[model samples]
Target: MGWLWDNAVTLATIVMAAAAVAALVYAHLSITENRAAERRANANELWRERS
Candidate 1:
């Protein structure tokens, strides 16, 4: 734990990088899920229109 205090800057930089990566991954997954939901809604609308 003393090493962490001694290398606080380095540790913080690593933590920030990890957080950025996690954010990007979460954003990508959200976008993908939203697109899938949009597609299903569109398909349902089209079917209703035809029926």
Candidate 2:
């Protein structure tokens, strides 16, 4: 379509921005999950030591 052709660059920019945002969200969630797992492991270790 003529309209799509005219706005091709704008569409591409929006797509790239969305992809970047998605990547950042995925990275943040992964880091949070890893931190939670680390805390759980530390707690377990402390419990074992006390027992």
Candidate 3:
């Protein structure tokens, strides 16, 4: 078990990789939300005309 505890560089690399993956996941969610909002606005405008 000491071998696993001895590699600081490997542990740092794994942490950085995990953070990068989390950032990508958040970005994907943001794009999806923005797209849905735009579609909802368009749909509302079409149905909102009083004339």
- Residue lDDT tens for model 2, 1-51: 999999999999999999999999999999999999999999999999999
List residue ranges in candidate 1 displaced over 4 A: none
Better of 1 and 2 by TM-score: 2
TM-score of 3: 0.81
lDDT of 1 by residue, 1-51 (tens): 899899999989999999999999999999999999999999999999999
Q: Could you arrange the candidates by lDDT from highest to lowest?
A: 2, 1, 3
Name the 10 consecutive residues with the lowest summed lDDT in model 3.
Answer: 42-51
Candidates in order, TM-scores: namely 0.92, 0.94, 0.81
**Each candidate: RMSD to true structure?**
0.9, 0.6, 1.9
Q: Tell me how far the alpha carbon of residue 25 in candidate 3 is from the true structure, in angstroms, after superposition.
A: 0.3
Whole-model lDDT values for every prediction = 0.98, 1.00, 0.94
Most accurate candidate by lDDT: 2
The TM-score that candidate 2 achieves is 0.94
What ranges in model 2 sit over 4 Å off?
A: none
Q: Give lDDT: candidate 3, residue 26.
A: 100
Error of 1 at 27 (Å): 0.4
lDDT of prediction 1: 0.98
Worst 10 residues of 2 by lDDT: 1-10
